[model samples]
Target chain A: MKGTLIKTVLIGISLGLIWYTNSHLDIYNLSIVNNIGIFAILALSYNLINGVAGQFSLEPNGFVAIGAYMTAIFIIPMDTKIDMYALMDPAPVILQMQANFPIALLAGGLTSALMAFLLSVPVFRVRGDYLAIVTLGFGFIIRIFAMNSPAYTNGAMGLNDIPEFADFRWIGSITIFTFMVMIHVIYSKYGRAMKAIRDDEDAAVAMGVNTFKVKTYAFMTSAFFEGIGGGLLASFLSTIAPDQFTFLLTFYLLIIIVLGGLGSMTGTLVSAIVIGFGLEWLRFLDDNMNIFGYETGAHPGMRMVVFSILLIITMLFARRGLFGDRELSDILKSKRASKRKDA
Target chain B: MSKGILKIENITMQFGGVTAIDNLSFEVQKKEIYGLIGPNGAGKTTIFNIITGNYHPTKGEIIFGDETITGTKPNLVVQKGIARTFQNIRLFKSMSVLDNILIGFHNQSHYSYLEAIFRLPRYFGQEKKIKAEAMAILDEFDLTSFADHKATDLSYGNQRKVEIARAVATNPSLLLLDEPAAGMNPSETEDLSTIIHKIKQDFDLTILLIEHDMKFVNNMCDLVTVLDYGEKIFDGKPADAIVNEKVITAYLGDFTHA
Candidate 1:
C-alpha cells in the first residue's frame, strides 16, 4: 500500500514537472527535451529486443523509417504531397490516405509492427551473430527501397510539411507511458520468458517457454514503439528524408542502450538522456576553436570523432554499462538495506 | 514393474558424418529414478537431448505416456509433462530464485498479454497465486531464505537444487536431469540424493538422469542403463552393472598384470 502510494505521488510529481517545463522552456530547449523524450522511447523499445530478449537485431532503423514515412504520408495534406512529389506522380493510395494526428501515429506504428511480423518468419530462424547480420541487411534494404520508390516515398527528395502534431506534451506523456509499460513487462511472466531465452535458449525451451513466440512478441512490441518514435520525429522536424533514417540512427540507439546497460530499463532511460543531450552539447566541437589565440579550422563531423573516443573509453572502463543488468530500484533497495545494517 | 512410461526404440542421432548415438534403446518405468551412466562422450547426454526433443533422432521414435513425442518441439515436450536441467547449471542468470522458478510455471499462467499490460484483475490474481506457489516450492527445498537472491549467486549445490525446483514448478510427470550431482561435494551429493527421492515421492515424477558418479547412481536409481559408444552395454540392477565385465572394461581398460 505504501509503495503504491509512493509511486502514484512520484508519477504525479513527474507529470507536474513536465507540464511546467512544457510551458516555460524556450523553443530551443523544448526541442532538445522533446528529442530526448523520443529517443528515450526508441531506446527503451530497442532494449526489449537487444538487451532484454538478448537478440542482437539491427533493424530499428528500418522500422523507424517505415514509421516516419507512414505517419508523414497519412498526416500530410494531399495538396502538399502533390506539390512535394516532384520526381513522379504520387501513388493513388498515398493521395487518398488521410488521418487525424493520433490515428496517423497509430497507422505508422501498426505498419512497422506488420513489417516486424513478416520479418520474424525469416529473421527468427537465425540466432546470435547471424540474426545481427540478417537485421543489418534488412536496415540497408529499407533505405535502398525508400530511395528507389518515388511514387510512394518521393525517392531521394523525401517528404516535407509534415503536420506538427508531436509536441512536448505528447512526447513526454508517451515516454512515461512507454517506461511504465516496459517496467510492467519486465516484471511479468512474458518478460521472465524472454530473460530465460536470453540466459539460455535451450533451458528456456525445456522450461516450456515457446521461445519463438516470445521473441516475435518482443520484436513486434519493439517495432511498434520505434515506429511511434519515428512518427514523433517526423512531426517534430516537419521534414524527413531517406537519408535521415539510416544505419547511423540505429547505431546511435545502440550506443545509448549499451551505455545505459543492456537489460536495465532505468539504465536505458538515464543513458538516453545523457547521450541525447551529449550529442547536442558536443556540437560545439565541430565549430572552429580559438583556443589560446590559435584558431583551429572548423572540422565537420568532429563531434562524431569525439563520441567514438568516449565510447571506446566507456567500453574500456565499464563494459557492462552503467547498471550492469540491474535496475536503479534494485541498487537503491540494496543501499537502504546496507544502511539499516550499519544502524 | 508396471509398463514403461517412456520407451526409446532404436533411436539414432547423427551429426552430419559423425554418429553420436547409434541405435540406442531404453525403457523407464513410471515414478522410477532411472540412471543413464557412461564415460565422457558416451552418448548419455545425447539420449537426454533426443528424449527432450532438442535433437530429433535421425531415425527412431520416443513414446512418452502413450504419446509419440518424436520430433516434438522442446517447449511442447515440456508442456506434455517433461522438464530438464542442463549439465552446466543453466539457471536464468541475474534473476532471483523465485523468478526463475516462476518461469517454470510459464505455461500454467493463462492471463492474456492484454491483461498483463493493463494490470487487469486476472493478471494480479494469477501472478499473486503463482508467486505464492513459487514460494511454497522454495520452502519445500529449504531455499525460501534465498528466494530473493540471484540464482547464480547461490552455492553450486543450491543452484542445482534450484534448477530441480524450477523443473518441478512445471509440474512434469517426467523429469530429465543432466548430471545433477556433477560438481557437488559428498555431503551435498548426499543431500541431493535425499532431495531427489523426496521430489519423486512428493511430485510423483519419473526421473531419468545422466551422471558420471557411480555412487550417486547406485544409491538413487531403481534401474540403470550403461552405454558405451551409444550402444547399451548393460541394462539391469545397479549392483550387477557394477560387476559386469563389459561395463567394467568400458570404464577401465582390461587389467594387465605387470
Candidate 2:
C-alpha cells in the first residue's frame, strides 16, 4: 500500500511537470507534445485488450470514429458555418447550454462503450483470427455508416467547426489519469484473471472464471477509453472525417502495442510516447531525403515504409517487445541494482 | 444413513452410437471417500465429466444438494460447491502456484472491478485475507516454498499436489479427483494418500476419486465401485469389493491368480 502511494505521488509530480512544460512551450512543439499524449491514451486503450487482456481486437478506429462524431455532434455549434456550408441545424436549445468539452467527451466515451457492449456479445464468441476479422469488420461498418449518415454526421463532407476540447492541458491530464487507471487495473486480481483466461481458457474456466464475462468486460472498458481518445483527437483537429478512422489507425495502435510488448502496460506507455512522437519526427524524412545521387523529396508513403521496417526488425530481433511484460517500475528496479553494482 | 450429496440416476452418455456411460446410477454420501475403479476404456473419466457438468447426460437426472446441476456451465457447477481436478494436470502454466489457487477463489471473492481499480479499502482487505487463506491451503500441502514458482515448473508429484490445492481452494462440500495417484513413485503415492485423507478431514469434504492403483484404493476408500465395460459389477465396502468374484475377474482376467 505504501509502495503504491509513493508510486502514485511520483507519477503525479512527473505529470504535473509535463503539463506545465506543455502549456508554456512554443506553439509548434506544444501541438506535437499534445498529439503524443493523446495518441498515448489511444494506444494504451488498445493495449487493454491486446496486451493485458490478451484479446486481439482491431476496432480502435471504430470506437474512435464514434467518439469523434459524438463529440462533434455535442460540442460543435450547429449554427457555426463551415466554409459557407451550414453543416448542422442550429444547436438545440437544451444542448446550447449543456454543450461543454468534458460533457461531450464523456458522452463520446459512453456512446462507444454502449456500442462495444452490443458488438462484443457476438464478436467475442469467436477466438483468434476469427475474432480479429469480426473486429475489423466492425471498424469498416462504423466507417461506412459514418460515410452514409449525411444528416447526423455530414457524410463524406465531414463535420467541421468542432470546439477545441483537447489542448495540451486536457490531453496531458486525461492521459496521466488513464495510464494510472490502467496500471492499477493490470496489477489487480481481475487483471490476473484476464491473463489466466488468455493463457488457458479451459483451465481458467475450471478455476471458476467466467471467461466470456471477463472478455466482454475488458472489451467494453477498452472501448470506453478508445472513445475518449477519439473525442480528444476530433476536438484537437476541430474537424472529423470518416477517412481518418481507418484500418491504418488500428494498424498504428497495434504497432504501438507490439513495439511495447503484449501484456505489458509499462511497455505500452513507453512505446506510445516514443512511436507517437517518433512518427512525427520521421515525417521530416518523407519530405527531404537524398538517395545516392538522387533527391527523394518527401516520398509519399515513407512513414508506412519506415514503420513496416521497424515492425519487421522488432519482430525478428526483439519479439518480446520493448518492456516484455515488465512495467516501468520493474525496469527501474532492475536498473538501480545494476547501477549499484557498477558503483 | 447420511443424505446423498450427489445423485446421478439412469445417466446415458453417447457419442455417435457409442455409449460411454450407459444407464449409470450412483449416489455419493456425505463425508465419504467413494472410489470408482474401472479397467481401461471402462468410462470412469466420462462419469466424472458428466457429474461435474462438462457433458450433458443423454437421459438422466443429476441432483446435487437438492438442485439439478446437469448441463449447467462448469463454472456454475463450481460455484454451486462442486470442484474437480483433471486426470491430466491442468494448472495455469504461466501463473504462480498461489495465483492458481486464488483463481479457485474467484467466485468467493466479493471485490468489484471498481474496487480493484481504485485499490479501495475493501479490495485490500479482501485481497489480504484471501492471500492469507491461500497460503494456509498451500501450507497444508507443504507447497508454501513453491508458491511463487510457475505451476508448470513443478515436478509431476508437486503438480498433482498443486492441482489438488487449487480444487480444495474453492471450499467445496464435494471434491472430485480423477486419478490422483496415476503416475507416482510408491513414496509419492503414499504421500498423496495421506494428503487426501488429511484434506478430507481438514475441510470436512465428501470426495469421489477415480484411481487404478488397487493398493491405494483399498487403503484409502471407505466404499468402492467397480466398473467393467461401462457396467458396474460391484458396489460395496473396499474389502468386499476386493473379494467380489466379478471384480477379481475384471482385474486379473479369470481370477485364477487372485
Candidate 3:
C-alpha cells in the first residue's frame, strides 16, 4: 500500500513536469526530454533481456530497426510514401497506408516480437559470447537489409516526414507505464522463473520451470518494448534512416544500463535519463570554436571520446554500477532504520 | 506382490561405444525408501539421470505410476510428480534460501503473466498461499531462521537438507536424491537417514536414493538394490543384501579366479 502511494505520487510529479515542459519549453529542450523518456524505455527493455534474464544478448538494435521500419511503412501518408519511394517503385500493399498512432505502435511491437520469436529458435541455441556474436551479426544484417531494400525502406536515403504523434505526454505516459510493468514483472512469479534460469538453467529446469519457454517469453517481451520505444523515437523525430538504428545505438543503451546497474530497474531509469540528457547537453563539444581567438575548430567525435572515458571511469570505480543490483527501496529502508536507531 | 510406484525396466544408456548403464532394472514401491548402492562409476547417477529425463535410456523405458515416461524433458518429468536434487548441491547460489524454495513452486502457479504484472486478485491470492506454504515448510524443518540467508551461506549439512526441502516443495509423489549424505559427518549422516525415513512417511513420498554410506543404506532403506558396473547384482531386504555373495563381490572385488 505504501509502495503504491509512493509510485502514484512520483508518477504525478513526472506528469506535472511533462505538462509544464510541453507548454513552456522550446522544441529543442522538449526533444531532449523526449529522448530521455524514450531512452529510459529502451534501456529498461534492454536490461530485462541482458541484465535480469542474464542472456547477454546484443539484439536490441535489430529489433529496434524492425520497429522503426514497420512504423515508417505503416504510418507514412500515401502521398508522402509516393515522394519517399519515387526513386524506386513503392511496394503496393504497404504504400500510402495511414494507421493511427496506437495501431502503428502496436504493429511495430508485434512485428518486432514475431521477428524475435523466430530468431530465438536459432539464436538461443547458442549462449554467452557466441550468442553475442550472432546477435551482433544479426544487427548488422538488419541495417544492411534495410540499405539494400529500396522498396520497403527507401534504400540508403531513408524515410522522412514521419507523423509526430509522440510528444511529451505520449512519451511520458508510456515511459511510466513501461517502467511500472517491468517492475511488476521483476516481483512476479514469471520474473522469479527468469531469474532462476539466470542463476542456474539446469536447476531451474529440474525445479519444473520450462527454461526455454520462460526465456522465450522474456525475449519476446523485451523485443516488444524495444520496438515500441523505437517507433516512438521515429514518430517524435519526424524522420528516420537506416543508419539511425545501428549497433552504436545498441551500445549507447548498453552503456546506460551498465552505468545504472544490471538487474536494477531504478538504476537503469536514472542512468538512461542522465546519459540521454547528457548526450544532448554535451553536443557543444562537437561545435567549431574560436575560443580565446585560437580557432580551436570543431572536433567531429569529441562527445563520444568523453563519453567513452566516462564509461571506463565508471567501470573502474563502480564495477557493479551505481546500485550494484540493490534497489532504492533497500537503501531507503536501511537509511530509515539507521535514523530511528540514532533517535 | 503389489505394483511399484516407479519401475525402471531394462534401462540401457550408452555414450558412444561405452555403456554407462546396461540392462539395469529396479522397482521402488510407494511410500517406501529404496536404496541404490553401487561402486564408483557403476552408473547409479546415470540411472537417476534417465529416470528424471536428463538423459534417455538407449534401450528401455521408465514407468512411473502406470505411465511410461521414457524421453520426456526434465521440466515435464517434474510436473509429472517427480523431483530431484543433485550429487553436488545445485542450489541457485546467489538467491536467498526462501527464493530457492519458492522457485520449486514455479509449475504450481496458475496465474498468468498478465495477472502477475497487473497484480490481479489471483496473483496476490496465489502468492500469499505459496508464501505461506513455503514458510510452513521452513518452520517445520527448523530452517525458518536461515530462510533469508543465501542458499550457499548454509553449512554443507544444512545445504543438503535445504535441497530436500526444496525438492519436497515441488509436491512430488516420487523423490530422487543423488548422494544426499555425500559429505556429511557421521552425526549428520544419521540425522539425514532419520529425516529421509521420516519424510517418506510424512510426505507420503516414494524415495529412491543413491548412497555410498553402508550404514545409511542398512538403517533407513526398506529395500536395497545393488549395482556392479550398471548391472543389478542384488535386490532384497538390507539384511539379506549385506550377506549376498554377488553384492559382496561387487563392493569387495572378486577373488574366485585368483
> Which 10 consecutive positions of candidate 3 chain B have the poorest summed lDDT?
B193-202
lDDT per residue for candidate 1 within A91-118, as digits (tens), equals 9999999998889889999999998999
Q: Pull out the clashing pairs in model 3.
A: A78-A96
Ranking by DockQ: 1, 3, 2
Ranking by lDDT: 1, 3, 2
Best candidate per DockQ, number? 1
DockQ of 2: 0.64
lDDT by residue (B1-258, candidate 3, tens digit) is 766999988889999999989898888888888999889999999999999998978999899998999999899999999999999998887677888889998877789988987888898888888889888878766789888777898999999988998999999999999989999999998888777777777788888889988888888789988888888888899889889999888888888986
Residue runs of model 3 more than 4 Å from their true location after superposition: A125-133, A281-298, A330-343, B243-245, B252-258
Give candidates' CA RMSD values in order.
1.8, 3.3, 2.8
lDDT of 1 by residue, B176-206 (tens): 9999999899999999999899989988999
Local distance difference test, per candidate? 0.90, 0.84, 0.87
Quick one: how many clashes does candidate 3 have?
1
Q: Write the per-residue lDDT of candidate 2 for residues B1-258, one digit (tens) a residue.
A: 799999988888898799888788888999999999988889899898887777888889899989988899888888898899999888877677988888888877788988887778988888888899999999999999888677888999999999999999988999999999989999999999999999999999999999999899999998888888888888888888877889878877984655
True-vs-predicted CA distance for residue B32, candidate 1, Å: 1.2
* Of candidates 3 and 2, the better by TM-score: 3
Choose 1 or 2, whichever is better by lDDT: 1
Worst window of 10 by summed lDDT in candidate 1 chain A: A122-131
Model 3: residue A337 alpha-carbon error in angstroms:
8.3
lDDT of 3 by residue, A1-343 (tens): 6867988899899889888888899988888888999989899999888888888889889988888888877888888788778558888877856688899998999988998888788877655566678779889999999999888788988889998888988888889888888888877778888888888888888999987777887888899999998899889888888898888889989999999998788999999888888887898999887878788789988999999999999999999898766568756865786687699
